[model samples]
Target chain A: MPELLSDAFEQVQRDVDAAFDAFLPVPQDTRARLVEAMRYAVIGGGKRVRPLLVCATAKLFGVDRDAAVAAGCAVEAIHAYSLIHDDLPCMDDDDLRHGKPTLHKVYDEATAVLAGDCLHALAFDILTMPGTSSDPFVRAELVATLARASGHEGMAGGQMMDIVSDEEEYDLRQVTRLQQLKTGALLAASVEMGAVLGKVPPEGRTHLRAYARDIGLAFQIADDLLDVEGDEAKAGKALRKDEGQGKQTFVTLMGRDKARAQAKMLVDQAGEHLASYGNDAQVLVELAHFVVKRDH
Target chain B: MPELLSDAFEQVQRDVDAAFDAFLPVPQDTRARLVEAMRYAVIGGGKRVRPLLVCATAKLFGVDRDAAVAAGCAVEAIHAYSLIHDDLPCMDDDDLRHGKPTLHKVYDEATAVLAGDCLHALAFDILTMPGTSSDPFVRAELVATLARASGHEGMAGGQMMDIVSDEEEYDLRQVTRLQQLKTGALLAASVEMGAVLGKVPPEGRTHLRAYARDIGLAFQIADDLLDVEGDEAKAGKALRKDEGQGKQTFVTLMGRDKARAQAKMLVDQAGEHLASYGNDAQVLVELAHFVVKRDH
Candidate 1:
């Protein structure tokens, strides 16, 4: 990994951890348990990939670092809440995430549900705060983008497709479409929101959009590969369950070698989209490479 | 019921149904089930009380009817989503709502969870749309207000209290604090957001806030009375569950007749807060009276 990208990831992790810690203070009341569950779900976990994407993209246009990190926190909150609900008994029924017991395993299922819900609301609340951006237009746009990406037409819709995948046989195209909505939408929103914070007009974001799209697909293909062959200890959660369920994925459809090649090709293409930004785009370029190459 | 208040409720129900129908369209994909569940939860159910409150308050300041309805739809989305999750097997464990099977009972638990999440996101999505407000500040404020009301410190926190009430012996004051967060927050937010849409400054909303607070408490007291004495067929849900669980409620803490008298007193107080608006506040006053008087 490049030093710049590694340092950026460390910075994002620190900032996001601090932000969530300050945002959620366990009240001295019966509601304390709910807040604790929410804190457990969000703090000190994951790679902070979404935050890194937001900061990296925002940096290109010289957006404020704090504002970028705030937006990243909002995106990560959505991601964290989705994971909580997805790990429930009715969904993946997983007991481990980030190498710890999933929320429902640690707390009851009811707490897990409420914590996820509270985190979901907290995402929009964070974006609307003046700390995110002084301009109301920027804040409103961020909320709109994140809301659209996380809702019926985006992550939740893709999750529905995944649930039905057990009973239905899907082709590569179908799987791709499903993953696109399930994962790609939020990834794209991260970059788009960064651009919005920088006041970049819609017409000026074609290359950034293309870059996000390429990396989003590459990221998923790599994930499918990881599930098929990665070490469970390093992955920090259950792997190989995708195959056990007989779910079709990029790895199952394209073979490991082809999927690896495709991801590498996509990463390369993603880097090409940032060519006009010169040296300022170096971190983003390295982040794309890391997306496919990371062990986790 | 007064004709003015009854007519307002009818108008709100029709407009909110139409708005949700237009906002959510089932796609020709596996996502159709999720969308269907979302539509089912939002349309053709409940009293549309929140929407009526929004339109009524917005009318006080002469805000645009279409824009007021759009904001009302956003609030209704949040209310509907909360009911879906609250009815889940892991939460209240109910099988019925609004005279129909709960989302989990009709579909599946995973579908219900996803549907609730999608609607939660859709609430913010609707608020950010051009149809809700032309001004960016209003849109941002709407998101902020709704998000705060629905999240950890408000509705979710109240729910956490309710869940623990089964094990804890809560006094009247504790129960009031719990209900204030659980039910009062969202109801108050309905009136606040309506005032926000009409550009009523926060200082100008003191009387309106008082009115919301009074009616919010009155509404819950009435709910408790209904649980003790109302018809299950009319309520469209299981009654007497509070006593079944040995939970302390307004009726249990304040006795049935005293609770009924208190609700009526609060309703009258709520009407007094609207006296400054004269005829314009007539429907709101009637709505407050209806809050404690309705059988369901």
Candidate 2:
């Protein structure tokens, strides 16, 4: 059954990659560098955990495949854009991503900036396009959710906090809030968009939203744990970066054993949020466990 | 009357400023710096020319004043965000904007970058919100147009060309193309969004679009001339920036007299594009003439 879950994840990942490719082809002319950097950053990479949540949730509701794929790719675009910006010299200053030179290093800093900017625009562009949904209301909902998740009250706000968080100390509660805004917003939006695509009633989405929040917190704790214990080669990026950068991640504040226990407990609780759906929620339950279990 | 046009411009500027203030208030906590930077970048500055275009065009179709103002604010957000990024140390490295210290100089590089980024997201956030338009179709159209005009093929792509055009050496046609994308896209979108909000039929938009394109080009040409001959106090920023930077501009390449003549001719042609609408487009016509004749 775990193997079957792996199979489902891979299928969604491949489908999402195809969607990215179809929407974004490498430009052969003047704007090629920005286009190529965007394609390079988005394609052929990472765990695609957000896309999996979107696709799995959509499947539970029998939403159209194309709608699910479009939503998945929109979330993935936001994730990729954030990574590119995070790698900038003025930001995290990292030079490696997925074991390759970061976008700013591979391309010039200016191109890196524009590529990230364009990709952010592209996420909304893809979601609102006709392929995503026939109804404009649905498209607006997707656009609104994605924009809210990606913007000041969400990921960017979290990043601002992290920039200053290094200089000023914060308590566990503050750190948790930062993590929720920085990481949880997009993760929650991925599941939220799936329900949107499925036309889930406003009142009907409570369980799914609860499920997303639990796994989102668990996902961050898992990332913190992996940073401390993961193999660099398997992670496809730097590991154990918190201490070097003065970042007070969950592992640093809570210790590895406690963080690990907390992640597992959250995953179990996330699975329980789907009690109303019973067997229909099996993939989501597996995903909750997989989120904490995965090394990368 | 030119005097009447000037009075109308001030009116819309005040209204747009009020809209921006409503959407972006200064935050009080950890993220205060970013929110402050956004407010500073957006408020109390510029000619408010782009917002004028949105309001004037909407006036032609009698589009709701609130919708027009919302769309105007969205385009202004894109403009403010672009100015912030352009003033980055890696880009234009500007020290002054609107006679005030630039965002990066005021609040460090990282905060400036994120503030600009968040403002970009805030534009989409505002456009898709309920207050922007009651019809979701109108909201989606506004979002799609703004995203396209702001992203790779539009402002950002134009910016990428501007960064390298100094080294690569482009002709007048290339420069015009770059300026169209870099500066023209958002201006054109302002008018287009006004029409969209008014729900103009596809064919009905042709003249408005042609008018927008003509004025957009004229606006850039006027800007080039201002960089050569504008008063520092009136312009509220550095003048002669093009010459000090050694970049070839319309004034530099074509000579001031010729560029001035070209701008005047464009303004006339822009007015002619509104011939079908006659008196209804008087504001747009006056704005075109102002583009060529204004001191700043």
The candidate scoring highest on lDDT is: 1
Query: What DockQ do you compute for every candidate structure?
Result: 0.96, 0.77
Q: Clashes in model 2: which pairs?
A: none
What shift in Å separates residue A295 of candidate 1 from its native position after superposition? 1.7
- Candidate 2 residue-wise lDDT, A205-286, digit = tens: 9999999999989999998888888998877788878878888889889999999999989998899999988888888899
Model 2 ranges with Cα > 4 A deviation: B244-246
Question: Candidate 2, A244: how far from true, in Å?
Answer: 2.7
Q: Model 1, which residues run further than 4 Å from truth? A: none
Tens digits of per-residue lDDT, candidate 2, B1-296, equal: 48779898889889988998898776655887778888898888888888889888988888888888888998998899889888888788888888888999999888988998898899899999999898999898899999999888888888887887777677888889889988889889998988998899778998888888888888888999888878987876778888887887888789989988888888898899999888888888999898878876
Error of 1 at B2 (Å): 1.6
What TM-score fits each model?
Answer: 0.99, 0.96
